[model samples]
Target: MEIDYSHIKVIGFDADDTLWVNETYFREAEEEVGKLLSHYETPNKIDQELYKMELKNLGTYGYGVKGFVLSMIELAVELSNGKVSNSIISDILNIGKRMLNKPIELLEGVEEVLKTLSKDYRLILATKGDLLDQERKLEKSGLIDYFHHIEVLSEKQEYNYSRLLKHLDIKPSEFLMVGNSLKSDILPLINIGSEAIHVPFHTTWQHEKVSENETNGVDYKTVYSLLEILKFFKNN
Candidate 1:
């Protein structure tokens, strides 16, 4: 089946793994936390428990490094029966700091793609994460000028995208979303009658994964690299 880009006037980009390195840092932090809490449980068990903790606390802390750090600390206490050392807790805090401070490493051709597309289409950033952290990353990315609008969403769902389109005065058919996660970036837009292109990262957070059945009949394009998306745009 062929998907058309003729009607797409606004191109929405997902900030994290789609444009630059993001999930990679979380994976590294998870490994570090796993090692730090190894005394309480095995590495695998620690990883599993920590994910559960994050899911459990998602509502309370929303998303980003701070919430992840809190989940790690809470899990450490739980796994250790509240006897986890303060030094270990401090180590987890430092891990979050390192992740938050890490330099932005843009994926290949990100700037070129954004620059080329922005010329012919309105480019907006619609990503979900901590507002402060997302803003910090955008400023550091040096790609801020390419985007006409930047939105840090609490969640990426059909309703969220619908509301965004409404607020921007964009029709569903005029918006196109590009991102790595199938769950957050692809499915929601498709569900809302907008277009989406998937550019899968090497590593995906467990929560952002979708089952095969969920994508079985979905109509969306998947490109191996961000640059490949240029082929679908007439201006490029």
Candidate 2:
């Protein structure tokens, strides 16, 4: 397939699954949550309730393991009619703590790609999550030096990208974003006249999943892996 980077000056990368293992841990934690709450309801029902809790609390608490753990605590109370034990609550908290301590496992070619791109274009780590958590991961990844800036957004929307570009003093047409979520990474940039590439992760948060109808005529390209991007550049 053909592509263009002729006018691209600044490139943005998404963290979590795009750069390393992320959604996989969330999946594991959810299963553990199910087991912990199994006495009150079936695992499937537990999952459904948890998803609803997450949605209801998204605006209140935003994203990250802290919000997730709190949601789980609230769900436990509701499902058990406030009879859930302290031990169970402690287990849920521990789950979040363990997730916080997870090692940064970079995806294949992450360093090589960043190192190569930094030489020719300004790169930014633009991902959405809790500020403190994201910083820890970026520091741990040891890829911090390659980025010219780091933006940990509360949300990824058209307006958000527009404001970010304005802050960076870059034009939409000159910015290119690459990441795993179509909802968060690709469509919004395209909507704002910036370019995007969809590098899909094997696991996506349900909240970040988008429908075909939402993407019908929008222009973007999808690559299977992160490093495949180097081929699009002139001097790679």
Candidate 3:
């Protein structure tokens, strides 16, 4: 089925893995945390338990390196029966700090895609994470100038997208979302009657994984890279 994008006036981009290197760092941090907690449990067990902790605390900590770090600490204490050492706790804190301070490495053709598309369509950044951290990344990305509006959402759901569209005074048909997560970025927009394009990253967070049944018959385009998306709007 060939979809039409002629009506899309505002293009929304997801900031993290979709535009820059994000989930990769999370994976690395998880590996580091696994090693740090190996004394309490096997590496695989630590990894599994840490993911569970993150999910358990999602509502409390929301999403970001801060939340992730807190989850790691909680897991350390729990797995070690409150006997986890201060030095190990300190190591966990440093891991989060390192992740927070990591440089923004933009994905291939991110600038060219944004630069070209911004010339014709209104481009807005719609990403969910720690507002401060997201802002810091945008500022450092040097791509902030291309966006007309920036939204750091607490969550990405159908209602959230609907509210965003209403706030922007644009119909769902007039908006298009591009991102990496099928759960947060693609499914929500599709459910809200908006268009979305999936540009997957090499690594995905476990929380973002969606089953095939969830995507069955969903009418969204999956492009291999950001540069490939330019073709869809070539005639515009």
> Can you tell me which runs of candidate 3 are displaced by over 4 Å?
1-3
Residue by residue across 1-236, what tens digits does model 1's lDDT show? 55568988999999999999999999999899989988889999999999999999999999999999999999999999999998998999999999999999999999999999999999999999899999999999999999999999999999888998999999998899999999999999998888999999999999988899999999999998999999898643
When 1 and 2 are scored with TM-score, the better candidate is 2
Q: Supply candidate 2's per-residue lDDT for 51.
A: 94
Candidate 2, residue 74: lDDT:
99
Candidate 1 residue 36 C-alpha distance from true site, Å: 0.9
- Cα error, candidate 2, residue 230 (Å): 0.4
Clashing pairs in 2: none
Candidate 2 structure quality by residue, lDDT tens digits, 6-60: 8899999999899999999999999999999999999999999999999999999
Candidate 2 at residue 83, lDDT? 99
TM-scores of all candidate predictions against the true structure: 0.98, 0.98, 0.98
* Candidate-wise lDDT, in order: 0.93, 0.93, 0.94
Off by over 4 Å in 2: none
Model 3's alpha-carbon lDDT is 0.94
| Least well predicted 10-residue stretch by lDDT in candidate 1 | 1-10
Q: For residues 28-112, could you state the per-residue lDDT of candidate 3 as single tens digits?
A: 9989998998888899998899899999999999999999999999999999999999999999999999999999999999999
| Global fold similarity of model 1 (TM-score) | 0.98
